[model samples]
Target: MLKFTQNKTPKLNFKKALKKPIPVKCVQIDEPFEVETMEGVMKGKAGDWLMIGVNDEKYVCDASIFKKTYELMK
Candidate 1:
């Protein structure tokens, strides 16, 4: 019996989606805390961002990434 191997073809072009920036309520955690998210409970550390989504869902975001991704609304 002979076994054949399948070769995968790569796509030449990639599609990109435009993301709109929407504001959400977020607060910086002063101490370690746990937030109950839709997925499950998530742990947040001090200086991290605890975001409350439009649906009132809570989630944690790293401080570094948050700073880079979000800016204060003036």
Candidate 2:
């Protein structure tokens, strides 16, 4: 038998990009819906976010994740 657990911090040399900001389109949904993405068709719940990326890729993101991961482009 073998047992292992993840209790180590990442040691990979990852750095944030210092590139130009490219804005995308984002909208909030008022009802459950589905959208086509590069990955495939995905379902979203009310209050989720629909994001259209730089290359016109469309996808849905949960409201909580959208809030934590993105900001309004003002």
Candidate 3:
């Protein structure tokens, strides 16, 4: 015979969670962005963000999207 167990953890409120201020780091894009050669596709600026390539290739993205993504990464 076997016994069964149940989880009683409460569900988190995501909407309320987002209300808190998130801490992030400030970084500058030092070079021209290449879209094709990037890995770990993180968020971008405006519409595009930035990515660090597996082979040391860096890219720049739109401002809005990058801000959003940068916050998440922070």
Q: Estimate each model's TM-score.
A: 0.76, 0.73, 0.26
The ten-residue window of minimal lDDT in model 2 covers 2-11
Ranking of models by TM-score: 1, 2, 3
In order, the Cα lDDT scores of the candidates are: 0.87, 0.90, 0.50
lDDT by residue for model 3 over 1-74, one digit each (tens)?
75445765445554533444544333455544445434554444344445553455666646666666555552
Q: Rank all candidate structures by their lDDT, best first, as comma-separated numbers.
A: 2, 1, 3
How do the residues 1-74 of candidate 1 rate in per-residue lDDT, one tens digit apiece?
Answer: 85545685455476888656878899999999998999999999999999988888889999999988899787
Candidate 2 runs further than 4 Å off: 1-11, 16-20
Off by over 4 Å in 1: 1-12
Instruction: Report the candidate with higher TM-score, 2 versus 3.
Output: 2
Give the C-alpha miss distance for residue 74 in model 1, angstroms. Answer: 1.7
Candidate 2 has a TM-score of: 0.73
Assess candidate 3 and give its TM-score to the true structure.
0.26
Backbone clashes under 3 angstroms, per model? 0, 0, 17
